[model samples]
Target chain A: MPSSATSNTNGHATSHTKALAKPTVNQTPNAWSFFAVPRPIKRIFDRFPLLTYPANRLPERVQRVKSADGHALFIWCAPEDASENRASFNPACLRWQAFLKSQNLQFHTVSSSNHASTNERLPFLVVNPSCSSPFKSNIVSAHELAKWAVDQKDSWPVELELHYEPYMSLLNNEIRRAWQYHMYLSPNFEAFTAPSYIHSQTNSSVVRITSSWELQKAAREDLMKSSPRIDVEGLYASADRAFFALDNLLKRKRRMVADVSAPSLLEATLFSYLFLLLELPLDRWLDNRLPEIARKYPELVELENTLKKQYGLQPPAIYDALTGTKDSTLNSRTRLEKHFGIR
Target chain B: MTSRLNLKIWPSGDGFPFPSLNVDCLAAIAYFQLLWRTTDNAVNWTIISDWDASQSPNGQFPVLSCSCEKEIAGILNIFQHVGSCDSINGHSDLNSWMNEDELADCTAWSSHVLTLGTQLLDLYLFITYENYYSTTRPAYTAFLPLYANYTIPPAHQKAAEKRTEHLGLATILGEIDDEPRMQPISLRTGGVDPSASASASFTEKIGFGNRKEILSKAQKRMRLESIVARFLEPLEELLGKKRYFLSNKSPSSLDALVLAYLSLILEVKVPDRWAAEIVENSKLTDWIKREAPHIYGNAPNKG
Candidate 1:
């Protein structure tokens, strides 16, 4: 009765009827006809074997992963083409892919946005069932996927395990702050990151603007949490110290690769942050400090180059934009100038 | 074995297990009761309506104290915590009708309501001078001592103003005023009066800023109407003829959220009833009226 009254006044009476009509039947039922499905038919439909789809299906030969902005979720390192190493712009996705590659796990990349993710984040992993396990394909991300890898015995050795939490905290806190500040809070957000990353995640202009605002607000709040106010100078100062510490750590060992023959979890995490910072087109926004670190630190640059070769990651197009590399066809200089108003 | 769960909310001026005055407390209680009824969980929850929020973990209510002595603050956190507990039933029968896609839709719609609906509520109750002075301020500070009543309302108003500014809606709507503008009539009369030459001079000194403020406020109110319209139209379309917002099945959490906001907007009496009038014209009013008795166990008296 309430539905009828509301529908009549709201001018949705027709649509209401249409909404209730199942697609296959295409017959509009009366207002009270929700109970029209006979009890025997319901029972028979429930018991029908063909009607029920089996929960488990054959595992896919390759794993499918979703990244933000429909970019490939892996570093594309073509031996023949050094420029092809830059595929995905998302550092988190690159980190995840690099970690998987370091473990010698085989995965195929697919372009997807954060909207497809269960957690509304980028870089989710989908594991296909193998002959050894009958479990269906499972989608996991973040800590859950990390745990899955651990369960499969693809984890850091005990020596590196002691340093995992400390190093992770370092990267998550100091390095993450710098990254968020560089990407979201910086003035370039409205010009570059917003259009390139955030806007591409959604088609709706309202959602895009609102989401960008919320994301920036969250980043600001996070930055403010450590201090009374946002001290950009102090933040960068600490960031410089953090980078310095990381540079020293990597410099001492020639590479972060330990005696276990596999790259430690620390190396994976470090590479994730370092590669993102070194590769991103934040040259215009950044105050020359981080870029200076990449230039001055031989070990850091060497590690990045080594990882690019190891993972077969093609340099992303953003790399060309940052380096002012001119292409014969598109002319990168003109494109940057026209779009970003940079001469 | 059933575990003892205690829910602490803001104390009500009137003695009631659930206060109808505070919309958040009402919604929290409604959400708790709905979950309790739909699940086979042995949750012996006692509503401590008189509890103060100061003792809470985050200095806000409603706080849920679980059997494990972990205090979860805020309604969302409390719900998530309780839902994750082993004692409570994992899945609600209300949500069983929805598929994964429908559930995702429900979440998106629920977020929309929470964000826009709360902003609308804030605008109606706190930003508009008429409603703030006549209704919201009194509702929050009436029970306090004279000194506290006088002090707290302005503080609360300032905080609300700050929040609106942070959300950027205030700037877009042009409500960011450093000081309240003097009336043009006061300036005009002072300038015209022969004996009040000094007052006239003072009026002239501040008149430009005052005029801009008045004009901006007028412009903002007009713009606010369109913003509210944009928010409501999509929600109305999504609801369509379904009993719930996004699902044809039983009421989900999104239903509870919609019911909470709609009921609050309709039932709460305020001087600036622009938002309430808008709600009255929509199908949401009828939905709230229909669901009130079932959710709250008693029909809420419309203000």
Candidate 2:
């Protein structure tokens, strides 16, 4: 999911002009000016407890950027075949849509054919800054769009949710091969519904650069700040909400552990098991860092509280309760099994 | 009133007999029965197979039925009257019940298998109808141009002469002689081998190389049986020790299709050496014996 906020560059024009005149401040960081200086993301790092680790400590493969309103934009893509069954909106696209819907974003669906026709004439607008759109515009040519996004970064705070459909159809052509390579550079562009056939292109399931407090800090320093902050809490809360839907749909009310259904018990069972496996560790990460993260970005605290109350997740307290030492009294013995509707 | 269904499958007298009533139609019958059961046994359905030898009804399939209708339209009308239910996708109330992802998964699986099977049928048609083969040994020369003419006239004649050494001409080819001047070659008449050729054995067993090769080759060709094991292994693991695979719940359409295909493959007997070895293998033989009987039953029509 890409972040909804982008930076409005129009603000601080006088300060930018003054900084432009000063050669010291204007000096390029190596050849790429963007690479040299730490953006507003630096302050975002200082906001979280464990996440405040130095910017260089993070993995280079994961790129974090901001939307126009200074919201973090995290994007990824999944390439798949042109089969008729999945022609309109495939499983990967549906999953992304479901995720977006869960986040309470106002979404729009446009055909790649329509986008290709009008993209050059129209400037892509970041509509519904409050994350109201359930969907982002799915641009056809991701590489060109990514390059265009980087070029237009100075002009507007708009983020590109680049669609990877064009490259998929060109698998036979050798000359236009490095579309995926170009895709890696666009920090905000995401590919969706990636086919199993395209797995060889990248060694990842689907690239998702989780926009954390660091990216927000980058926007705070380098981009224009806006009022009302644009539903930052909703972004995080939506993820848990989607999980809650799955819970209601799949799990028996009493078991707290989800078992597979007869038609697809194997797939469902594995999916449920994997979700729990990922959630336990994630809950811990959120719990330990909530206080400091709450202080810096108050929305994060509210998001954390929502997750804790709704999902029965408390990273730090649960960790203490499970440790079961003489010093601990949390009584977290309520088996995680009960949560999945298992006996 | 008990509605009687009179099914007439297409291609009239000589097409692959509507899988039912054919010597080996049990698997197809089981499939139809399961299809009915999956739909809550709603429709009193009859399948009519039209053989190729049957008369064409003025560039249309011949169909006759009651219910104040005529032709294919009449048959369908009769079906509707008997079943009183629209097809699966056409049912409105059923669509609401099917919106659940569990039902969606079954539909998806069925569609996936149907697509794959349909493509394979297309390939089979292409091969059987278009490909050339040896007239003497149809089994030995499928999809291969075994009867193709050689360039040189004398060489082609010489090659044709040696073709007879390949197999017993009468048994390998049809017993009927095409050339009126040539006498009929009778080896086996009425399942009894003649005294002269009785001492002689069939050296070529269709696809097998030689009589001596059956043992070593049977051991080597044991891998084909692994497919049956592979198919059943997933059912056991995913389905667990339960009757159905999805959850320990009632079987859905997905289970029915898979169970039918498994029985068909198990029951499909071919005299090819590889197929024989596959049937002879204890693991596959035992698995087939256990699973096939449970899914299907002793010849329903025969009783």
The best candidate by DockQ is 1
What TM-score fits each model? 0.43, 0.28
- Per-residue lDDT tens digits of candidate 1, residues B1-303? 567777766544432223644556666767766666666433456777543345665444667788777777644445446656665444333445665445435444544555566667777667777667667766665455666667655755655565455455644432334443343443556544444555656786987535755786577656676657655766777778998776665667667777777777776666556677777877667778887777877422221
Model 2, B1-303: lDDT tens per residue?
Answer: 433333343311122222431211232344445545555554344555443312323211223332323232211122222233333222312122333445433333343333233222222211112211221123212222334223222232223333222222213122222233233355656444355343333423354434454574454334334533433343344454555545453544445455444443334332222323343453434444554554455322321
Q: List the candidate 2 regions with Cα displacement exceeding 4 Å.
A: A1-343, B6-28, B31-47, B51-233, B243-256, B269-287, B291-303
Clashes of 2: 66
- Candidate 2 is graded, for docking, as incorrect
- Which lDDT values do the candidates have, in the order given? 0.58, 0.30
**Candidate with best TM-score:** 1
CA lDDT, candidate 2, residue A45? 41
Q: Model 2: how far is A122 from its true place, Å?
A: 23
DockQ of each: 0.01, 0.00
